[model samples]
Target: MSDTRRRPRHVGAKLLLLILVCYFLVPVWWLVVASTKNAEGLFAGDGALWFSGFHLADNLRHLITINNGEYLRWLGNSLLYASAGGIGCTIVSVLAGYGFAKFDFRGRNIVFAMVLGSVMVPLTALVIPTFVMMSNAGLTDTIWAVILPSLLSPFAVYLMRVYAAASVPDELLDAARIDGAGELRTFVRVALPLMRPGVVTVLLLSVVSTWNNYFLPLTMLSSSKLYPLTVGLGLWTQLASSNNGGGESLWNLIITGSLVSIVPLVIAFLTLQKYWQSGLAAGSVK
Candidate 1:
């Protein structure tokens, strides 16, 4: 009698999970299908969710060749920005978080409270203020304008603090101290290894945020040569929408560029998946 009752609940949960899977995957499937079609086929193709023809190669060729290969330049800029910002932000967050978790100092609560408060404020709200500061500092239109602002992620710091407090134990640090390990040595040799999972999580989040950043870069950079993929693709979209010429052709290129832009992020996630898997295994063993 109990078995019959549990069967329906299990079946219902599986059905719900299947529905969510389809909901997320449908758009990706559409993107893949649309990338294969020309602009005309994309809008007036035989099916919206199915491939009409394969023009992906021609579109990619044009994507790289058009405007002296501007798309490639944008791709490189994004890579540089994301890699630099992500790694820098991860370092800052880890140090700040570890300090907060392990040490006690006057005004610590007050400062951490301010950080937590800042997290509630939307990043878009701060762009104008950031632009003004960058302007005053003579950094506007330079890579520093974008990269500097991205290096401070309050949320990442908060995440690291929470993870550090939970994952790192006071007893372990005390043991390291009794063994004559200095604070720096203790952190690098003992605490850091245990914090690997949190570090990787924060790293991936920072990387994705920097890679997809658009509005801040848009506000800060005016030169097309300095534009990242987000800003560059946005420019193509705006130009394509206007009635100058070659609207549909540009649209095709835009679709292909959008598809190409996501490849690096996908590759990064897949490549780093094993680190997370190993981290989980280590945690389980402990």
Candidate 2:
């Protein structure tokens, strides 16, 4: 194609990309702006983007102090769930994926097929059944109810399996074996290091999913003390909606709480983004 003919198309594509970026980012921009304002300013501030106030500290203090600092507890619970689930899920996914990718065990194909099939199953659909099982086993209302289920991520397994198969060389495994390395030793020293990118990706995915999980925690736990950020914020919103004898606007607290709950996920993304991008690039190269 001639340069002149392609110029308009390029300009149009740039414009479309800009539009999509703004469409997705405007809400986040609004949130950052809104979080800085007090209850009155949030509703009264016409310039949601430009308006500023000194209520951020006050709002944060209130959020921390609400119901005797339950917000902090919720945050702690979320951190616990996300950390436990992320680490556990990453380990399980890596081991399972390594086996599937490298081993030649009997029924391997059938087992892989089953795992892939599980990936297609929606987690929401399994929540009730999972809850029933947890309840039967006397695990309900405990952190285990949330952590146990998140430890097994079918999608993570699939990702690890694909990445391992592509990135790990069979020759490397054989070389380690010849050098007097046991299977566990080879896996830990060789395969695991080689699969860093995939492991980081799975870790990020698992943490994010477990951090933002609402339905699972809600269904499994009835104690507010054990509630994660998602469920706690949800309960706050519900209370705000139901009560009217409030001094400060509960709506502001709800909005602020929602904003606070998002901070961890943002931090997790920023921290692990390099690993995910590098891993994906390396996997593609393989």
- TM for every model, in the order presented, reads 0.94, 0.96
Measured on C-alpha atoms, candidate 2 has an lDDT of: 0.90
Please report the candidate that would top TM-score against the real structure.
2
TM-score of 1: 0.94
Which regions in candidate 1 have their CA more than 4 angstroms from the true location? 274-286
Q: Name the regions of candidate 2 deviating beyond 4 angstroms.
A: 244-248
Clashing pairs in 2: none
Q: Tell how far residue 138 is off in model 2, in angstroms.
A: 0.4
**Model 2 per-residue lDDT tens digits across residues 1-286:** 6999999999999999999999999998887778778878887848887656768788888889878999999999999999999999999999999999999999999999999999899999999999999999999999999999999999999999999999899999999999999999999899999999989999998999999899999999999999999999888777767785243477777778888888888888898899989877875644
- Tens digits of per-residue lDDT, candidate 1, 195-283, equal 99888878888999999999999999999999999999999989888944478888888888999999988998898887666544544
